[model samples]
Target: MNLISCAALAAALCISVHAAAAAPVKIVAAENFYADVARQIGGAHVQVTSILNNPDQDPHLFEASPSVGRALTHAKIVVYNGADYDPWMDKLLSASKASDRRTIVTGQLAHKQSGDNPHLWYDPSVMPLVAKELATTLEASDPPNAQDYAKNLQSFLAALKPIDARIKAIKAKYASTPVTATEPVFGYMAKALGLDMRNEHFQLSVMNDTEPSASDTAAFESDLRNHAVKLFIYNSQASDGAATRMLALAKQSGVPVLGVTETAPAGKSFQRWMLNELAAVEKALAH
Candidate 1:
């Protein structure tokens, strides 16, 4: 090849490599739901690593590993649900001491406290706020692609309108329906749909890995046996024996049980996952 041809080819290759390396932002999320939202907003300009992506894994019992710490330490942006939900992540972030890293705590953004419900992602309003914060962070990190991030943020916020509508629709049709869960995994969403959540003490006991008092257990069983609740929501990822027994009782009593996961399922978006669960609840109550 001629000298001119070789020089031109090398210059083009260098530009391609530089662009590839420079075009994207690096993000690490403690949960897959936030990671999915980041992916939607960042699109092709972000690489997201979600530590808790397994639906079968109990998020309540998660422990930090060296590799996870390394990822957080090196990440340009780290997103996690705070409010004592994932305290290990806070420790990791503090240990890393990354002055420039952008951290978006969805729990804190929603005014959630340490004793409040830790599952902020399930709340419809939380992600949109997180998405907006993420867009701002991404734009600050990658000014060259700021417009793309802004457009993506708007699209994501717009997409959530349908989910909100579905929640309103469920409220219109099935509001005030009695429901209970082995854990309060769906508590926020249930409240949004106006579900009368019963057995609060039992659910909270199971959530905290403490044994439910005999009285609370009896009340839960009684609610199931008497068909007082229309739907039973189960955190399919939790491993408590009390929750398991409650599930069996729920089945035997013919109460419709719905399985919910802590993280988004593989190949599903955050909006899609929420809608799917809401659809299930609506269907169970439709009968």
Candidate 2:
């Protein structure tokens, strides 16, 4: 081939590589749970980002920062829990007006009805669906690597099977077992496993960041003293004075206490942290 022809071909190849590298898949997740899932599915192909890392802070009260706006602006795909949770993400996505960016709202999943619990990830069935949606979205954005993305997604789904099996085993062993929690953070998992919640009113009030009424507090205390509950599930991150009192009561009453946290605890992977928390509950119930 002529020198000129060879030079032109090299230039074209360089341009193609540059364009591909510049458009790597970008994902922004509203919370760490989605972030972890995205990382598992996206692997080395996508850059995943999350806004909330603090387990103690209420996501409802999150304030958007300039960096968050920049992340939203550049994301090729966004994943968030909808249903008025993380409303800031919706506002930022609307303002960005990026037509090509695909947003996956967990609340839009098939089983998620309006006013249904926004904590979809805790429901074992929901994560696979989210992973599937993420794979589809990533495939659309980077069609050249669609096969790899699908493989990654399949692996993620398979990894979750053990967790599902564990949950089933727990349900079989402790159906209708009574448990109490300071808030609704563990409600989805508990309900899915058929555990009876003994203090619904108190949980709802605390989950909404409000003070439980006198009647609700009295009922919760009565249940604890009467030994109506086998275990006390507390969100270690969001513990308050009332929750502290409940924990003490549980210890005093010989009811085992299980400490749970919303975000992934310090050194543990997301899956390990979650399973460990549930295992602690199982241990408490068995004692």
Candidate 3:
């Protein structure tokens, strides 16, 4: 090729490379599941960061810092579990207001209020709304790659089909099964599976970080001791003293225990994480 033609091609290649690198949308999620979902929807066009990403730790105990504040301020789009689930995220957003920032609250999409269950990720319908909102926000952020974002959203939705079918299958197989928990972390999924989840007062008390009433505690203990429930679903991440005691009692009673979580486990996609947890419940129920 002629020298002039070679130089022109090299310059064009550099511009193309720079444009490709700049196409990604900056996104931040308060929790990892939402980040995973956003990543599924945004695909190669979005760069995502999650603040509460430790699957081994309780997200409710997250301590915010200056770095978190900077992340919120710098992100073009941010997602958080609202209804007081991550009030710190709200505080960060309030403090880090920007003209083009888009904030998505998963709880609000699920129509949750302050006193309502904050574990909205367990609800089947939450992420669909989140994915839609995220795609719209991402399209606006990177108009040149809007079609890619839309296509990724469709792909993510299609991928969820098997997970949804599995959930239905489990619900059908274990409809109206008796169960109990230390907290309401898996309450939505339990309801979907048609479980007669007992000890609401105790679960709510634990979730609200308060002491369960004597009657509530007695009922929980009685249920565990007598095998009144077939399964005990515990939040392994939030195992406080009461939860630890309940876990021991449940194990002693021979009722199978299923551990659920607020964060996605290490090396799991959001869909895979949920399916695995449901499979655990299924395995426990099969006995």
Q: Could you tell which candidate, 2 or 3, scores higher by lDDT?
A: 3
- Write candidate 2's Cα lDDT for 1-287 as tens digits: 99999999999999999888656689999988888889988888889888888877756667999899899888999998886667788888877888788999888864566545566667777778889999999988888889989999999887877788889999999999988888777888998889998888888777666888899899888888898888888877775777888889888988788877766755555577668877887888898
| Clash counts for the predictions, in order | 0, 0, 0
* Pairs of residues at least 3 apart in sequence or in different chains that clash in candidate 2: none
Cα RMSD, each candidate: 3.2, 2.4, 3.3
State each model's CA lDDT, in order. 0.90, 0.83, 0.88
Instruction: Encode model 1's per-residue lDDT on 1-287: one tens digit a residue.
Output: 99999999999999998887686688999999899999999999999999998898888888888999888877999999998888898788888988889899988789887778788877887888999999999999988889999999999989899999999999998888999999888999999999899999998888788999999999999999999999999998887999999999999989998899988898899999999998999998876
Can you write out model 3's per-residue Cα lDDT over 78-117, one digit (the tens) per residue? 9999999888887788888998888888887888888998
Better of 1 and 3 by lDDT: 1
Best by lDDT: 1
Better of 2 and 3 by TM-score: 3
* Candidate 1: Cα lDDT at 144: 82
Q: How close to the true structure is residue 180 of candidate 3, measured as C-alpha lDDT? A: 97
Q: After superposing candidate 2 on the true structure, give the runs of residues whose Cα lies further than 4 Å from its correct spot.
A: 1-15, 18-23, 110-115
User: Could you give the candidate ranking by lDDT, starting with the highest?
Assistant: 1, 3, 2
Off by over 4 Å in 3: 1-21
| True lDDT of residue 282, candidate 1 | 94
